[model samples]
Target: MLREALDEANNWIGKVPGVVMVGEGRAQDGSPTVDVWVTQPVSLPQKVKGVEVRVRNSGDIQAQ
Candidate 1:
């Protein structure tokens, strides 16, 4: 279920500006979550497909 939610969340990448990365993770309470990393603050939903969406502000990312 969480995997499916993560897959659905990945679809938001590129479609939303500032979004750099999307992956699966565990929330503070140990519940499943979809992690979203962005270069700057952007509007995002609190949850997707019943799973929590955790958004973090990560300055611009560069490939090494």
Candidate 2:
């Protein structure tokens, strides 16, 4: 599911001018999670777009 989201995100890149993707991760509330932050220029009126996928098990985290 995570890979699918990334693939979709990749397809959006270059098609939208002034768009950039940033990756981030964190462990909060005793759960591990990953996020993708898609940023665009503020003047363009589009705010940051993003997706977060929770890492369910240790195996899932290892796979990433």
Candidate 3:
């Protein structure tokens, strides 16, 4: 279930402005979640395919 949501998010993540990364993770309550990292605040759905979506601001990502 989580994998499905992760794949679905990854498929269109590039279309969203400010998004940098998306991955699978466990929420504070231990429930499955799709973590979304962004360089700035952006509007996103609260849930995707029944999985919770958590968004975090990661600032600018640079290659080292």
lDDT of each: 0.86, 0.38, 0.89
lDDT per residue as tens, model 3, 11-46: 997469899899888988899999999998889999
Residue-level lDDT tens digits of model 1 in 2-51 = 98888888886547989988988897789998889899888999989999
lDDT score, candidate 2: 0.38
Alpha-carbon deviation at 22 in model 2, angstroms = 5.6
- Supply the global lDDT for candidate 1: 0.86
Candidate 3, residue 40: CA error in Å? 1.1
Cα error of candidate 2 at position 5, Å: 0.2
Over 1-64, each residue of candidate 2 has an lDDT whose tens digit, in order, gives 4455545545653245444442335546643233333343322212123445422222212223
Error of 2 at 51 (Å): 3.6
Candidates arranged by lDDT, highest first: 3, 1, 2
Clashing pairs in 1: none
Best by lDDT: 3
User: What are the TM-scores, per candidate, against the unseen true structure?
Assistant: 0.86, 0.35, 0.89
Q: Give Cα distance to truth, residue 61, candidate 2, Å.
A: 31
Show model 2 residue runs off by greater than 4 Å: 22-50, 53-64
Q: What is the lDDT of residue 28 in candidate 3?
A: 84
lDDT of 3 at 14: 45
